[model samples]
Target: MNSARESLEAGYARARQDAARSLETKAGAVGAIATEGAGRDIGSTLLTMDSRLASLRRHSHDYADDLFRWHTVLQWLGWLALALIALKSFLYVLALELFHSDERMTLGFDDAQPIEGSYRTGAQLAIDRHFPHPLITRKQLSNADNHLVLAPWPGSSPLVRIIRRRYFFFARGSLLEDGGRVATVADTARGMVASAGGGQSIVEWTLREGEQVIFRYKDFFGASDNVSLRSELSLRLSTLLFGRVIFHSARCDSGEGRLLLKASVEAVDQAQLRAIPLERMIAWSRHAQFTVHSGRTPWKTLVNGFTLVRRDRGDGQHGLILVSSEDTGANTGSLRYLKRIFSSIF
Candidate 1:
């Protein structure tokens, strides 16, 4: 009986041990499954974050592209608006010309009467109308055709005087009025005749009585010949009077007349400037040319061309400024011009 009882207890103990091993094994397998599930969840979260970041980056690129497109559109619109203004000005001039022509025909107006006073007469009239002090007619020049007018500006030194003259009546000419003291700017062939002692300029432009063409020049110190930039500096056409423009600059040592004349002709042809109805190219401009740069670099230096300023003060009086070269001397004939134009225009 004792041996049977001991055998039963041993079998019960062995079964208990086996059951505990199986339970331990199942617990370890469940723990491993749970850990793997947690890892999968972490991986899924990372993938979602990466997708969101990529989407944000795409949105940023799209925004930048849209902004660039908008900027381009604005630039184009600005250019179009400028074009429309120019077109309007052109049409207005055309209509004015037609009206003037019709009136002239109906009234039987003489075409020559309007331009009766040549450039000289117009210039003299302009001076008398604008200048306060009376000009003393100087009889120093020998040329019968050439007339000299001398006037002293208010507050100006005795050394500096306003000297005006009509030159190159029939092309070939010579100025012998105090030879060394006078500064004369003749045709390109003549250039300028001046002595060490600088004096007032005598500008001899190729001007006709009633030719309505304005020639303006400017000089800039750069490699790029920015014609568009220069055009912005020109005088605005207030009426149907001014149109057809041309610009040219050769080397500092360029030959006179030929090159400039050629360039002007080419420009007129290219732009068809003849089609425009013009009245006169007012020749009340300075003729003297001064070298701004030092002697060393004189061969090639930038020159600001010319600024044409017309001051019409409601009365029949008119003031004109044709600055061929830049100088601001009160006596050199620039301050008077600036004063006249700025007083009216501004």
Candidate 2:
């Protein structure tokens, strides 16, 4: 009987040892799984950091390129200014010797009035006549924000004068300097701030008689459209320097004259002026117009509503005209004409 009890006790002790071994094996497997999961998580985090760093590097490289270009332009402007001073001195001497000695002769004072008068008259006629030709009839939409009239290009050579005017407008707004560079602006204190995709955070404020506004496309450098961002950038910069701010952009729509275009006017301050580096102030002049078409054209005939007339006076003479007429409500004459034309066809 004692021998049988000893055998049973020995069997129970062996069973307990086996159970302890099984528990230890399970605990080790759980620990191994936990360690492997943590390692995978660390790897994922490192990859994300590397991607962000690459983007930041690209932005820095672009910023450096813009700064170099701006510096070069400033150097060129300095040389040009010296040349202009010398020319003015020679003209002054010529005027004194050729004309009367007692009377003061002005270089371009007499010529200014006739050009201004013609511009005003031409703009008024363009609006009243409603000519549909792209060259003659740029319809003045009722919802238009700003009206500008540029003086006719002077001198016999229109190409040279036009080039000068174009450069003058471009340099004035930093548009020439950094307009080609995307929406990203360099902030020394804060690394680089860019909008996701093509949207930006806008601040709204009321504008007075002479303020500047910027109009930016939603997808300026997208694969879908080939619209140039430079024209609008140059126009915005030119207007801001010489006129008031009025932001306008076309909205998407299916039918003809459905949404037309949206306008946003904002007041510019010193902070905004100081923020942009590429814009150089050459001289302030009025009569600036710029337009950018959104790629999505709903109707087959995309009739534009924004009107700021550009007249080419043969021999390289071109001018932009703006009319200060009555705001005659939102139901503009152009919209009425569209309804009349579309009603008969559709």
Candidate 3:
């Protein structure tokens, strides 16, 4: 600004000097017997005046150009700031969605033949003809897979179904109603074994080398009382999405044989997951990871898989059904993500 002002003022001063000189020459020519010789060439004088006027115009243009450049620079900076703000807002929204989410998973039992169905998360789940709702009752099933495992879909909005959603299981001559016992689950060559009650009831499962494509729990219903069990089994292995998962819930109903399970779940390993997805988009639910452990040593450690202990004698007595969310050992992954988010915000 200072430079422009100085240059512009100099240009005006030069023009004024030329005009004054020209006026003096013209005055001499107007007088009779003029003193100044030839009144200083009129053509030369006019040329000088024109040149000075041009220089003034150029200085004015330069000042205007400088102002215009500053304006453009400011506009670009403003736009950049706004774009950054928008991007940050979008990321925060996605994080909040994951936090508020409670993925749905429902694993139950049903009788009666299932209605015709497809294999898509958004497709209608084939409803059991005898039982229409999502329930598990160990009754006589007619030509249908008894286990009803609803797939885990983190995409579904729990808020939409928040009115009041609860699941139920009716067990006749089964331990599901009794909440079972707390036992140690071990993975051995014989099969996956869940031992509780000092070896009173046994639950075991075995799998082949490959994954199973199509199988039903009813076919092996009388075979075992265990599903796919693994070691250091975190929810990370599963195809899970939205949700700050806290704890997982599972129920086992042993009926046909003294709660006697000696079959391998690996045979139909794909089947349980398939059943979960069996009515996913249609039913929406999600649980399978557990923090329940052997009652012998409380809070010290949890058995690798589901714990099968004696029946609950009182309301909060008996076994370990609930897993504390604050358990760092069980919730390492969940806590890490939460910590990262809060750290950025605060």
Inter-residue clash pairs, candidate 1? 188-256, 203-287, 217-305, 217-306, 218-304, 218-305, 219-303, 219-304, 219-305
* Model 2 lDDT, residue 176, Cα: 15
**Better model by TM-score, 1 or 2?**
2
- Which lDDT tens digits does candidate 1 get at residues 28-120? 999999999999999999999999999999999999999999999999998986685466445434433343333221111112112111121
Which runs in model 1 stand beyond 4 Å of their true positions? 1-232, 238-346
Candidate 2 local lDDT, 16-131, one digit each (tens)? 99999998899899999989998899999999999999989999999999999999999899898668445543442333233222222211111211111111111111121121
What shift in Å separates residue 60 of candidate 1 from its native position after superposition?
A: 4.2
The list of candidate 2 runs beyond 4 A from truth reads 1-9, 78-346
Local accuracy by lDDT, each model: 0.29, 0.29, 0.29
TM-scores for all candidates?
A: 0.25, 0.27, 0.20
Candidate 3 matches the true fold with a TM-score of 0.20
- Displacement of residue 200 (Cα, Å) in model 3 is 69
lDDT score, candidate 3, position 300 = 22
Better of 1 and 2 by lDDT: 1
Where is model 1 poorest over a 10-residue stretch in terms of lDDT?
Answer: 258-267
After the best TM-score superposition of candidate 3, give how far the Cα of residue 149 lies from its true spot, in angstroms.
Answer: 71
Residue 71: error of model 2 in Å? 3.4
